[model samples]
Target: MSTMSAKIVHISIDRDWREVYGYASRPQNMPFWASGLAFGLMQDGDDWIAEGTLGAARVRFTPHNDFGVIDHRVTLGSGLQVHNSLRIVPNGDGCEVMFTLLRLPGMTEEQFAADAAHVLRDLKTLKELMER
Candidate 1:
């Protein structure tokens, strides 16, 4: 299988890993940090309907687990689906939250870089919120 290019943007939070995962994994709290879902997400059965990022999209999040995995898939209105891998891992006395951003099909280097920047900003926002 072909592998897509990726960037893992992450931030360290001075909080427990489980606590960070619990707060961050909730859909209701996404808008506060995840700019793409800043407009908010509406529950639609098993998936959530979001109106941010690139127009309207449907997002499917992973089921809650003891492991700090919050992977999700976003399907755009155009049917382009993107998979995001997010994790909260113990780091020192706190935890590290990481987001893997994959370079989607037809994505230019400039676009990929911009996406990475956006993810970094989001992670920073998460760190700030969690540390507060």
Candidate 2:
């Protein structure tokens, strides 16, 4: 598969990487930081259902791991699937949470930029919640 344009949006959290990962990796905890899922998610089998602007999306999160990987795949109501790569890695006394935003096919420059901004906002929210 050809690589698409991608941007790594990240934020530093003043907390242990393991602690950050433990809280952030759970699908049930996402509504606190991920604005799109403000109403929270409902478990449907192994995938989670989150209602967004476009409609319900089926999100499948990666299994728990020691490497701090919290990747997920989202299948929108329209059947458009977006794979997200997220990670929490140690940075001295704190940690860095990173999200890889990819420019999908037919995405305009403005839309891609908006998506990056959205991801950044979510990460910032996570930082705030963890630091408090």
Candidate 3:
């Protein structure tokens, strides 16, 4: 397995960083910030399971706080297992978001890095959306 991490600093939105993060953390609110992403809720034992499209990838969200741990299984192409944890923190007049993704067995380091960049870009896009 391989590990990849990204940090996005200074997302200067007017709202409180915690609140903004909380908004993003919700499964129902994903499409608002993520633009094209779609999600559906299902019951999985005692926990709520969120199945959704994150860009071209199929992602599953397990509940957390203003942060989340995502289990992503790629569809329509190569099979990749991605486990990710996300956090948003206050930084100066803005906020900083940190993402850590661990690539499960069978995925290469290069693929993990490439996917990490994509994830960061998505965060940047979401930040822009929140700021505007």
Candidate 4:
């Protein structure tokens, strides 16, 4: 269990959940919208290994499906396992993407804030890419 609380950040997109899930669920597409993972990744079967803002990480994402669950686990270079729970749900005429930022032990308040901001930006990027 984490020592700190988790933060929920969300953004509404003008698209369907299927469309959002189709694009965001793929780890290969991460570099395009996720700034923290913009360095790209190497896929080895079900695992995606990449070096990014948080250092080298091995990521395992949820499989493709109609449900907009884009949850994934990231093992950092420091041996920290972070579980990111992301979801896309229908909202009126569009959809809303929600990202849960889990605060691990030893993480500063500022760092958590920065991570939340980064996720918000990434969601915005996804929206832009999908709406185009």
Per-model TM against the reference:
0.96, 0.96, 0.58, 0.92
> Whose TM-score is greatest here?
1
Instruction: Give the per-residue lDDT of model 4 (tens digit) for 99-118.
Output: 98887788799989987898
lDDT by residue for model 3 over 1-132, one digit each (tens)? 334344332234555677667777765666555433545444455334444543344455555653423333333224454455566777665677666555545557887777667666667777776777
Superposed model 2: Cα runs more than 4 Å off: none
Which segments of candidate 1 are over 4 A away from where they belong?
A: none
Please give the CA lDDT of all the candidate structures: 0.93, 0.93, 0.56, 0.87
What does the lDDT come to for candidate 2? 0.93
What's the residue-level lDDT of 111 in candidate 4?
A: 86
1 or 4, greater by TM-score: 1
Clashing pairs in 1: none
TM-score of model 3 relative to the true fold? 0.58
Model 1 RMSD in Å is 1.0
Kindly indicate the candidate among 2 and 4 with the higher lDDT. 2
Number of clashes recorded per candidate: 0, 0, 0, 0
lDDT of 4 at 15: 84
In candidate 3, stretches whose alpha carbon ends up further than 4 angstroms from where it belongs are: 1-15, 34-46, 50-83
Least well predicted 10-residue stretch by lDDT in candidate 1: 1-10
Supply the TM-score for candidate 4: 0.92
